[model samples]
Target: MTDPASPARPVAAAIRYLSIIVGCACLLLAAVCFAIACQVFIQTGVFAQSYVMVGLISAALGLLALTLSRVWK
Candidate 1:
């Protein structure tokens, strides 16, 4: 006779794997956003001359979102 808990093992494993995949995706997206923002700053030079704070804020927000999504249960 099979243990009752054995039947649910596959489902649990699938959920865990899916969650990890989603977390990685979020992180990857955030990285891309950060890279783009850096490129824009470098190309425009406007941010450097004027509002450096805004660029920093945007980067921080992207990082926060990535962290939250990854840790979400």
Candidate 2:
């Protein structure tokens, strides 16, 4: 009943799931960075500049990874 041209469904699903996982991890990292920044700010009464910087860097890296993955595929 299967067509020869039909791709393997499981493989495609796995790839989609992997991409979602990677995206979620990136978002989680960003969230953690934000939390750290908030804590630092609350403790020191100064803007958590360094925390923000770290967050931005992490986000950029995540975005780069996602972009490359898509492009290479």
Candidate 3:
């Protein structure tokens, strides 16, 4: 019979790589959101509260994902 632990190694690596990718994507999204929010406030003098909040949430999730990836192994 095959070793039960053999499949675990690759799975863990995949999870780590996926976590990093998601973290990067989320951070990029946060940047875009904040940029748009800034532009809107400058042009219309109206703060885009929703956009800013979304950005903040995305940033938090991204950081969490990165932390999980590092801590999982």
Candidate 4:
């Protein structure tokens, strides 16, 4: 059992909130990057693989963060 007045509790909650925020932001950024990649591909012959790679990495990280946040507590 944990104490309601513990200082660690507040810090942990803050970290969880921050993690959720970061996860959402990363997911949003990944979507934008993927959209841009598609536009770039359609306008030009280039595949824009770098943008796709970035999007994939961001998605993975975002999911991992969100999952870890839930699992932490």
The candidate that wins on lDDT is 3
Residue-level lDDT tens digits of model 2 in 1-73: 7665567656665676676578668867988998999998899988988878888887877776566557542
On residues 1-73, what C-alpha lDDT tens digit does candidate 4 reach at each position?
A: 9888989988888889989998998899899989999999999979999999999999998998898789765
Measured by TM-score, how close is model 3 to the native structure? Answer: 0.90
- As for lDDT, the candidate ahead, 3 or 4, is 3
CA lDDT, every model vs. true structure:
0.57, 0.75, 0.94, 0.90
- Two-way TM-score contest, 3 vs 4, winner: 4
Tens digits of lDDT, candidate 3, 32-73: 999999999999999999999999999999999999889977
Each prediction's number of clashing residue pairs: 0, 0, 0, 0
Residue 19, candidate 3: C-alpha displacement in angstroms: 0.4
List model 1 lDDT by residue over 5-42, tens digit each.
Answer: 78576765666666566656555655666666677778
Q: Which of candidates 1 and 3 is the stronger one according to lDDT?
A: 3
Candidate 1 overall Cα lDDT vs. reference? 0.57
Best model number under TM-score: 4
Give candidate 3 regions above 4 Å deviation: 1-5
* Candidate 2 C-alpha error for residue 5, in Å: 7.3
Q: TM-score rank, highest first?
A: 4, 3, 2, 1
> lDDT ranking from best to worst?
3, 4, 2, 1
